[model samples]
Target: MLTLLAQTGSAGADSQSLAFFNFITTHWQFCLLHFLEFAIWGAWIVVLGNLLNARGFTRKEIGSIYACMPIGTMISILILGPLADKYFSTQVMIGVLHLVGAVLLILMARTDNARRFYWLTLLYALAFSPTLGLVNAIVFKHDADIFGGLANQGFPWIRVFGTIGWIAAGLSHTLILKKGQPVNANPLLLAAGLSLVLGLYAFTLPADPSKVALAAADAVAGEPAVAAVADVGILQGSIEMLSRHPIFFLVTFVGAMAMGLYFAFGALFLEKTGVPPRTVGPVMTIGQWIEIFFMLALPWFLGKDNVNMNWVLLVGICAWAVRFGVFAIGKPLPMVLFGVAIHGICFDFFFAAGMVNANLIAPESLTATAQSVYGFLVYGLGMYLGSELSGWLNQYFTKPTTAADGTPDTVTNWRAFWAIPGVCVAICAGLFFMSTLGRPPAGDGSNAPAEIPAQASEVGE
Candidate 1:
């Protein structure tokens, strides 16, 4: 009997091992999909502002450059989201758009003229923004078939590769460029190469024609705009949620606008603060590295009932003030690093937690739409407005000057520049905190809005 039992146990173990091996072999493409998707983005975005600064573009021009992606995201939400859902294969659209974007990226790298680069970047943004949603759609549509009962586990593992890919992209700049090498177009070229590879690889993935994830903004898609616009009902429901949670609405809009200040100028800020060009890419990635840890720990912070939502979100919004305040101070490199590192908290705590709260607050029928609405407000309109204001402010603070080496140059009162957003966010935080004081905690039955059914109280929990 002992011998028979031993043999049976060995057989079961062997079967399990074989299944695990098959899982890895079949799902490797999805992992690569996410890795290359983010790698291509991280390769250039972290350093683009600094490069533009070096190229003699004004801070305002750079802000406009940054705005292109947000504009593209808004268009994709309204147009590409529906197109990918109804007419085209998700994989095919991703493959084609990325392939086109790769070409545009090459053009962008070649341009020395700011005007030309602006147009090229706008075109590239349109080509690239929709792919963010399409990639998520592919995973959501196929995870069930690929991982079966383990689909939940499979998604995060595959998604984590995106974070790794972003890290790799940043580290590559550190490795390839020597210290003090001037910022150049090389990052753009590297991104183009990766996009080419990703475009080709996307073709091999399974064909999917399903709808794009309305909650695309809920994920770390890129530079803050993770949403695509959806049904009118979703937009209406999102507006209602904002109306009901007046505090949430105000904090989210203002916080995202403040986030724009960083996205538009953080790289340039690092450069001005004495960070070497080669190391800046890796340094900017500090937040993303920290984000991985915070994201994993978020469930703990959120608690089982997510009763901590208000505090979590409030802290997240508050981090923006902290980061901007640190940047405004701009001394003691460690202090600056701390500000950079907390980007994870800013994103995971505020944005990610906010998405969860949105789902909880919305009725089941409006859940997906609610996600879309929140995304549109935060990343779409809010980010765009912020970008525009940041540009105008940077331009206002800048004055033309001659470099110490007797070359023509410009200087910005960066301290003053950063302080504006810092003060604005601080005010927003104070207002948000005050608003939450008398309100019921998130997930409580009393917290549910009149439009939400009673059972939503359980859902919130």
Candidate 2:
């Protein structure tokens, strides 16, 4: 009887293993698409500011340059996203934009002047921002077709490959360029090469039908072609929710600023604090590597039985404070790395979970509008403000000085610089914690399991 039960279990395991193997074999193209998509970003963004500093640009200049990406993203949502929804096939648009972006990246690598670099980076951002959304759209379009009811589960498996691609890019950048070499444009050049490859490869991807065709079909059936321009009601409702939920608004806004500060300076901070220049990319990637595990475990934390989103978000916000606090202390490398290792918690708990909370706070009819409001507030307005503020702080903490050998240079009070954001995030987390002490978890105040957005789980730098 025992042997019979053991054989049954063994057979089940074997069947599951075979099923997974088949799944991978069938979906390899989508996996590769997700991989190259992020590889293009991870290659250069981590170390771009550091490279600019090595070339003598000021912190303010670096901050301004970093701000462009968010600006471009905001613009794309207004223009490119709508246009893609109405006109172009997803894959064709992706291929053309990336191909154009590759040329812009190459130009950005060759240009040394900060202003010229700024303009080129903005242009590259405009060309690249649409692809992020487009990639997800195409993947979902196909995922629904392939997996039907299980598309959500299937997505994470393929998307994990993008994180791996990011990790690979970081390690590869370190490997290709040594610490002793001039911190030249090698990172951008590497990104350009990858972008070129992905551009050509995109053209060959499975063609998802254009959204325009669907809209046209609906029109022919005497349905509304568009919703007719008034999100006014939805917009008004979203604003009212934000006003009513000040804790939610404040916490999300502060957390986003913390994210902005990290993206702007985290790589440069590591390099400044005795991490080798070449190894900065890899060290920065430690967070992303940790991100994979935390993101996977997120559903468990946010399970229906848990019902403690306030606690989860507080912990995430506090993790950022800890991350910056350690960077300010800037001591034993292991502790610093520990701080970096917790980024998954910081991102997944705060930002990813916050998306669900946003969905819950708004009425069901206004779900999409609520998300758009949250994205605009956090990724758009919040990130832009935070980037600019971080740059200003960098400038404030930096001063011109002379080295021991008499070379003129600038030195930043790194401890002071890191402390500001750390303290700010800490204060926000504390306030949020205190506010939530007696309240129900963020949601509609019911026991329904929050429908977590698949896109929210996606890892980003």
Candidate 3:
């Protein structure tokens, strides 16, 4: 009997291992979905400003261009988020939008005139913004297929590939392009081509069927502007989810703030530390590449079945504070790389982990909106406010200096500027732990673990 049982157990283990391999293999489309989706952003995001500078655009004009996407996101989510969740298949919308965006991006590369470029970008943003939420919704919807009852584990594993795509795009900028010249229309051309490929590729991925039960957002998809606000409350489930776990909303806001600060000033700070401009994209991407390590381990850290979401978020906040401190020190190369690398901890814990938590408790009917709410808080509002604030701070802390040709150059007070955000985030991290915040309980409800005492009363509401 013992010999027979041992044989059965060994066969079972082998069978399970084979099944896991099959799952990963079959999910290549999802991985490509994430990879190409991010590659589109990566190709142009870091290089666009540099390219515009090369084109002789003013700072204000460039700032307006930067502002367009957030504005587009805020607007696009209203229509697309609801449409995907309630009325249309998510993957189909993703494909269609990318197709539209591809044309706009190509037009952007071909046009040098400011007004035409601005409008093309704005239109592209409208087409592109919803894809961020749509992709997350699609991934979350299919997570169960990857890990059966343990869906959250699959998210980080799958998401790590998106970081890879971003890294690949950065490398293309650094290695394939000539050294020391600002990334020109070529980056957008690359993005446009990728967008077109992804547009076609999206349709080949797994389907995310629209919810049969319609929500208020769907009823008003074509309605007038004011009607949307009055009617938008129809997203009662998503709204309730936020209200129930106020802490999630708070943490999301703070996470946005921290990331906003980093986005606004991180590159400039590194340049001040003497890193060359051409290398900036690769150096910055070091964070995303390293993020894969933490992302790989996240499932283990959060436990196989049940975990506390707040703990992960809190640690991420702490990592941000520490990372900011590292940046503040204004250290040299290898050491500075350590600071950049901390992004693995910072992003995986806060943003990526937060997504897991958001999906965990959200009603099936409202998953897209839930993710949209998070995106609007972080990428939309947070980034916009951060960019504006960073502009003011940049001017405030700058000292005018003369270059070798007697022309004026702006010397930023890097140490002081970096210290301000560092101190602020450290304080925020401390305050985050001390606050009475409720996190969405981790795990699918079938095997839910208890939450921390601070949020115990509000755990399931």
Candidate 4:
């Protein structure tokens, strides 16, 4: 009997191991999707301004081009969010959108006409922004119930690989691709290819649309006499639940504001620093590597016993301050590179942590809407404000000098340009510190009332 029991136990362990292996194998496609999605952006986003400049576009034009992303994201939140919830499978929508983006990317590669480039890029941005949220929805739909909470945990790990893909694309542009040119088509083509691959791969993800149908069916069965009433109740309940959480709304606003400044200033700072266009890829790679390491350790650092969300956010704010401070000081390339490394803390803590906090505060019925709202704020309105402001600032602080051939050369007052972001980070830090102090919520994962009120909450709290 003892021998039989031992044999049974061994078999059970083998079954458990196989189940875990199968889980990862089945879901591996989602990781690949994320990798390629980010790889597309990584190839061009950090260096697109330089490309435009090389092609005779002005600094203001480049800022306007970059600002398209946020604008597209904002527009999609109103249109795409409801459509994804009602009509299409999230994966199908993502696949279609990315495939369209791929074609637009190819079009971008073929164009030197600035006006054509601007419109095409706007199309690409609109298609791409919705996919970020859709991909997450698809991933969460497949995660096991026992491991549902692990969605945020494991998702970041997979997403970090996307950054790795980004770094690889960046390095490739610097080394094998650009051939030392200020602007090259290779990176854009590479991004296009990866996007196509992701579009094709997205079709293979585990089915998610069925759940929406199943919920509708269940609702019909439960209230056949009043099906319309039941539908209204679900919608009303979701809105009411979201409305009750003021902190969630406030944090979303803060997230938008911080991200706006970060994205806008990040591109402008690199351009002002006189970093050669080809070299910016590797410099960005250094920052991405730091981001990867920080993300890998985040679960441990922010887990139950370690740092609370407030402390993590505070450190992130400080890191942003330090990063821009280094830039403001007019440091050498190496020091500037080191400061860029703080991207790990700045992004992972502020943005990624904000996602986690959103997850914590959102009720199950409103989960998708809540997360989508956060994206809308950060990528849409926040980015819009950041890009416009940064452009104005760049125009104000940098004087135009004439090149030897009579073309204009833009010379930035690096100290003043960099100091602006440093001050922004300082203000973010102050707001966060005060919010944390006012309402000290139980930091131990209990769903106690959040310590901070919504209107005053910092970006990720």
Candidate 5:
């Protein structure tokens, strides 16, 4: 009888352990949500440029396809964010958007015409982008309920699965589609299928507290907002909040611009280094595989009592410069791969850290709005700018030349192209570091997030 009781106790402890590992929520729906959300994006985003290139599209034309996503993201965040924050259920919005986006993805697969492809993708992105913020809000709300701290303790671990999703997508492309060799292949269809699965799965997520309810809570006076934006309106309040905190806005711009170049031309850089068509996806996955480690490390790195998240961003952008420099050197597959692997540091530090920081600073009510405002500034407008800039850089560097076979070739001066962005980003990193040099991260605002709530909904009320 004693032994049986001990075993039962052990089983109970194991169940508790599992729940803690899952951030102690009723379920781990958000982790699955992140996985599917990113997997759909990963299915084609990493290789779509190369696919378009295979079809005889110019770099500029390929950029147009890439550019549409930011345009779509910007529109979704600006419009949908306010609507969701003010009126609708976050999970419901996510489900509906993914379903709509799935149809668009299917349509994208059926097209070979560039204009048709561009419009279809644009519509899909518009449908898909707002979910990024809504998912974050859901995760934050769950974290607040469970962990009750300024920083969401299990968020990094949860988000790391999203990276796993991207890795899985790349693995599928490499193992199944063989690095997206054909201009029209299985990528879009694969992504569409994944989107459909996630759409249906979204309805099963934890329910959200309405912004209207939260707004009412704020109006009760003395009790601060757990989920309402300030009286200035969701969009206006979010913008005002971001503007007040210059650090967030600055890093968002830098990170978004750097990402644009990576999204637009990263594969092309690998191709220049003689990576084979079949190997491209795997090679890229190496970076994300490395990122998984960094993502896991982030909680420790930035989770200290007062470790400034800005310091994390500083490391990321510096790594970005180093990566471009290494890519510029461009020889020996191992060397190129080594540099690519540093993406672990580059991406996790800036973008991932930025998301965490955004959470730290915004009130519970405005979490979605904060994420949306940041999304619009970075993913939408910032990515669009980067796409244009990178495209122009591509055009400027390509020149007519004679190859060893005396065939006319358009030569890409990869060294110069890579170095320019590297220098500029390095400077941006330095500037960011200087700005946050002595600022420690906020700590232990158990009743509220560590950020100043003067900019929040209940402040005046």
Candidate 6:
């Protein structure tokens, strides 16, 4: 279906048909690039906690390991985004990042020490963080229209293959990699191998460098306009833009708080509710699959004439609250599994919708920075705080009720731990409702009455 979509165009549209064919033929390498890129992360990420526990790593350290993701994301926002935009091709940068991450994974495989593991993982995360944005930039540059439906269609199709790669990795671990119990090495090896493949393949993709327009502007001026512009302190300009919109900051804070709470206990909730370790991977994968579906449908849904962004976001928050509530109540496994599907609306509506909202409000030149800011809030500040809180809560709520050997006398007080996030969600939802008392701006690409700059335009060429 994707191949057909990539090859065909409207009737009598010979030029567009040829362009579509050329796009597919030329960029076919991206399919493999993305496949391996995500395969590496997926191989172990969902199961890392189990692996750490098996190794007898402290629960606190395990939580800290999860914190690596957001911490890396935060660092990338501050340093990598600007550097990539200024100095490197997005494809090459991503390739290098993955290669470095692969090395770290290999090193992690060789280590039995927990501290060494944590330090190496953090390094790997730092190298890996910037690539997320770089890859998206590369894809969007090829198909510039943010609102163009075809661009949305192509990327998700490529990404879905990544999920397939993840499922393959999961099954490999379950069947071949581990004799019986879940082990760390299998997923790490799978991730490392795929990372190397992605790194090598990336060099072959179309070279997409930073500052195309600025470079063009420089060439016309014949005196390095980019250098002069950089010298004038662009950081200050971006910072000023952010300061003018206090509401964006508040939104970011709220998002971070909610996300932190979610990540801290989300998986633990399931584990306590009687879901087995083997089933966790499949259940989480179901959520990713659902998210891909929502991403495919998002442009259509948001583009509808009377769609309210706040309402969409509210629905997502409600889904999130219900998802946790279901887990808290310890429903049957199938019902709990069905609730995982809410991830599509919960994640997409919050993150993707927030990204689009930011795009609608930021200055054209600051689009990358604005996106980076959002990433910083969600992954960096939000997840870091959340992870720590989760670790503490996990220890606090889950008492050691049995000896090392299996025993029937064990008991767990799960309700209080689960309810903390529930209350947080309800409060955040209420705050959001109050903040957007008036309906969200229609999907006409108009900014709300908020003090957004006039220079920001939709990059959907």
TM-score per candidate: 0.86, 0.91, 0.76, 0.78, 0.77, 0.78
Writing each residue's lDDT as its tens digit, candidate 2 over 284-343 gives 888888888877778678778448777888888898899999989998888888878888
lDDT (Cα, 0-100) at 211 in candidate 1: 46
Candidates 1 and 4 compared: the better one by TM-score is: 1
Maximum-TM-score candidate: 2
Which one wins by lDDT: 2 or 5? 2
Q: Report the number of the highest-lDDT candidate.
A: 2
User: Which scores greater on lDDT, model 1 or model 5?
Assistant: 1
Ranking by lDDT: 2, 1, 5, 3, 4, 6
Q: Candidate 5, 66: how far from true, in Å?
A: 1.3
Candidate 5: residue pairs that collide: 226-365, 227-365, 228-365, 230-457
lDDT of 3: 0.66
What would the per-residue lDDT of candidate 1 be over residues 1-461, giving only the tens digit for each residue? 99999999999999877966676677888878988988898899888888888888877788898888878877877777666656777788889999999999999988989899999999998999788767765775664476553444445556667888888999899776667777888899899999999999889998762344423322322211223243445556666766777777677878877877788888878888889999898998888889888776776787756777778888988898899889889998899989999988888888777777776776666666666666676667777888888889999998989999998888888889888889988888889888878775556354422121111111000
Model 6 lDDT-worst window of ten:
452-461
lDDT of 5 at 246: 78
Name the better of 2 and 6 by TM-score: 2
| Candidate 4 weakest ten by summed lDDT | 452-461
Task: Please give the distance, in angstroms, between residue 43's alpha carbon in candidate 6 and its true position after superposition.
Answer: 1.2
RMSD of each: 7.0, 3.9, 6.9, 7.5, 7.0, 6.9
Instruction: Write candidate 4's Cα lDDT for 236-303 as tens digits.
Output: 64466457655445544554554555554564466456676667766777777877777666656666
lDDT of 3 by residue, 132-159 (tens): 6566556656544545535444444455
Candidate 1, poorest ten consecutive residues by summed lDDT: 452-461
Shift in Å, residue 326, candidate 5: 0.8
TM-score of 5: 0.77
Over 4 Å off in model 4, which ranges? 1-26, 144-153, 176-179, 204-209, 213-258, 261-268, 271-274, 303-307, 359-373, 404-407, 442-461
